[model samples]
Target: MAAFRSVLNVANSAKLALSSRTMASHPLAGLLGRLNHVAIATPDLEKSANFYKSLGAKVSEAVPQKEHGVYTVFVELPNSKIELLHPFGEKSPIQAFLNKNKDGGMHHICIEVRCIDEAVKAVRDKKIRTLGEKPKIGAHGKPVMFLHPKDCGGVLIELEQE
Candidate 1:
């Protein structure tokens, strides 16, 4: 019985050592940071802003992002933010989304990362596809990149630099 217990202990120790090594080898561990904001695609920016304001949330004015082909409004929250997006131009990216979700709906989630470059590389190494080759200046004036929705459980994910 003593010998059997000793063997079990050794096996457990080996398993623990392997687990530690695997975790340490993960490149994305501790790379991701806080939730930045949740984006919602809206057909009417003013109405959406009013909806949030009615809920006592402080909302910002609509800011046009010609480069991104969308207008953004930020609804301030205690912990994070709610981003309201509407089509700005004829080829707006959110236009298609709005077509599908006519009444407006949750668009994408933005997460902050410690380093955008490193995060991009790690995600690529792990076989995750990015929407663009490099990070672009996002609505918050920070470097941001979008990951392919299919690779991320059918939900678009935006990684912003902190």
Candidate 2:
């Protein structure tokens, strides 16, 4: 009887733990802010940026990220920006994405968060994995983290400091 009671208590505890975070709207919703940017993987960053420019979009200069092995550019919009990404080094993470996409397309979307640490914790508590390290400095020079696509409905989601 004691063992049965112990097992029941453990089951209830597990149920509460999962429910506390998975309930309506999610416990992490409050941590997410506005859409910062939508990233597009491109075989040719310059060409893509120019295309947006032709549409009257303000495009920034291509910035090569050696550590990340990708070149990046931001096309500024009224509410957000479009990030153009291209492979720079031999081991660029986007290489596989480009190989599969050929012409390249939307890769991910970045969202603003007031506290990166809190955001990470919230996602992790829900059993979602962060792509790389907890937080790395992104193009905007703000601490950022990425969530694995499998847990995020097939779209890579990036969280950045607001």
Candidate 3:
């Protein structure tokens, strides 16, 4: 009877350990915040900016982000914003995207996070791959990281620190 009780106790302890590990790996609530912006890859920056302006949206002037190899313009909306991306340099990251999508289209979506480091860890724990090992300064001058599109239902996801 004593030996049987010891075995039962060991099984119960193992089950509790497994459950604790599962809980620890689960994503924390409120890790992700509001949608920051939706990025669009455009061949003609001015035309795209004009289109938004024509729609009575407040559009920002093109700002060159040489480090990121793209020029960006923000179209302000009540809820969120639209980021228009144009290739800046020869090795612009969005060049291939523009080539494939000549008319311009939705590129990526940026979502705000309270803590970027914590968000990255949470995604990585769930086997999601980040585009870069560390977060980089994004167009909004905030720390941002892009998650692998393949893991995110065929859509590129950008997590920006808010």
Candidate 4:
């Protein structure tokens, strides 16, 4: 009787573990925050900025990151800024994604978070594939990491914490 009880206990524990795993893997589960910005790839940063400004985005100061070979412009909307990314190099990741997608439209959506490490851990624990394992510096000098589109439907999701 004692051995049977032990076996039943182990089985129950295994079932609980599996249930947690299922919840973690759910598409909508483990979402810690909301969208911060929507990034759009443009061949000309200034042109895109002007376009957005005309739409009442209140564009901010233009900043250039030579290391990543990108010229970033921000348009501050009521809630969030629409990030305009201009690729200065052929190897820019945004350029690659744009080329592959071949759609002149919304690129990636940024999500704001308080704890980047915790956010990344949650993503990993859920077995969601992420691009950068560790947080890296991003546009506007913010700490950010990208979750591959494969894990977030067909839209690239960037997690940002400043």
Candidate 5:
């Protein structure tokens, strides 16, 4: 229909505009690529994974990162992946997060970037606080860093190197 076509045109135009626009004040603007994954912290990773399985999702095995102190699992989907996270060691980085959110909920969202080092420096220069000393190799085997939730509108953001 003509009406539907017009609406689609407007939507496509909006997407193109957003994709090309860049911010001079914030260096990260126009740099972040796709939404790599959405992460959820779970008290019981097995139970959560099983719940997704009930919905007919293919879930990955629990992968533990000793340095990061979290066990991770990926719920593979047709278009994207959902990462299920759980605290592992005594000094898990997720402890404080779980302490505040007892039921464990959406933890962070990861966006891809071409170069994480450059991205880190740019955001750091803008006074954004990062979780650790430097980017660590994440579950995807890519260098990733976490931006403080306070600086990121109360939602933790992970920037992964593409």
Candidate 6:
């Protein structure tokens, strides 16, 4: 339909505009060639941490993520982290995700780039659909944005930086 096509054009144009602006402010532009971390969503944080510990990961202490309404535990590997999220409040993003997925599982894959804004632009140029209109302040004061799985070959990708 002509209307649908018009809507698509507008959305595409917006993506281009955003990508250009992001590139201008990119800090991680030098590091888009590697991955950073992976996030898993679980209803029970302790159980998840125990499971990863069995796999020989040195997990960090459970960190309270009050802003995101979740308790977070981190498994530090040589290259990446496996972050386990336990929902703490009804408004938690984990709670919303679990309600939709109906099970504990992989939530999002995060790539730690030197410049998050540049990575965002790269993904957008590849025609990936991003979730956040702009990078939001995440736990531990990190800036993060998520890319829609449908545009990422069925994988939810998160872009993050300090």
**Best-fitting candidate, scored by TM-score:** 1
lDDT of all the models against the reference? 0.95, 0.91, 0.94, 0.79, 0.90, 0.80
The lDDT, on a scale of 0 to 1, for candidate 6 is 0.80
Better of 3 and 4 by TM-score: 3
Q: Which stretches of candidate 1 lie over 4 Å from their true place?
A: 1-27
Better of 2 and 4 by lDDT: 2
Cα lDDT of model 2 by residue, 1-162, tens digit: 999999999999999988866754566767889999999999988789889999999899999988778899999999999999999888998998999999999999999999999999889989999997669998899999999999999999999999
Off by over 4 Å in 3: 1-28
Better of 1 and 6 by lDDT: 1
Per-residue accuracy of model 5 over 1-162 as CA lDDT, tens digit each: 999999999999988777666443346676788899999998889999999999999999999988789999999999889999999899996777799899899989999988999888888998999988889999999999999999999999999999
Task: Indicate the worst ten consecutive residues by lDDT in candidate 3.
Answer: 23-32
| Alpha-carbon runs more than 4 Å astray in model 6 | 1-31, 100-102
Rank order (by lDDT, best first): 1, 3, 2, 5, 6, 4
Best model number under lDDT = 1
User: Each model's TM-score, in the order given?
Assistant: 0.84, 0.83, 0.83, 0.74, 0.82, 0.69
User: Per-residue error at 43 for model 3, in Å?
Assistant: 0.8
Backbone atom clashes (below 3 Å) for every candidate: 0, 0, 0, 0, 0, 3
Pairs in steric clash, model 3: none
lDDT of 3: 0.94
lDDT of 4 by residue, 1-162 (tens): 999999999999999999999988876465657678898887667777888778876887678777666677888877777888777676776677567656446788998887788888888887888896698888857788889888788888888884
Q: Single out the weakest 10-residue window by summed lDDT for candidate 4.
A: 96-105
lDDT of 3 by residue, 68-109 (tens): 999999999999999999999999989989889989899999
Error of 4 at 144 (Å): 0.9
Model 5 scores worst on lDDT over the 10 consecutive residues at 19-28
Looking at model 5, residue 161 earns an lDDT score of 95
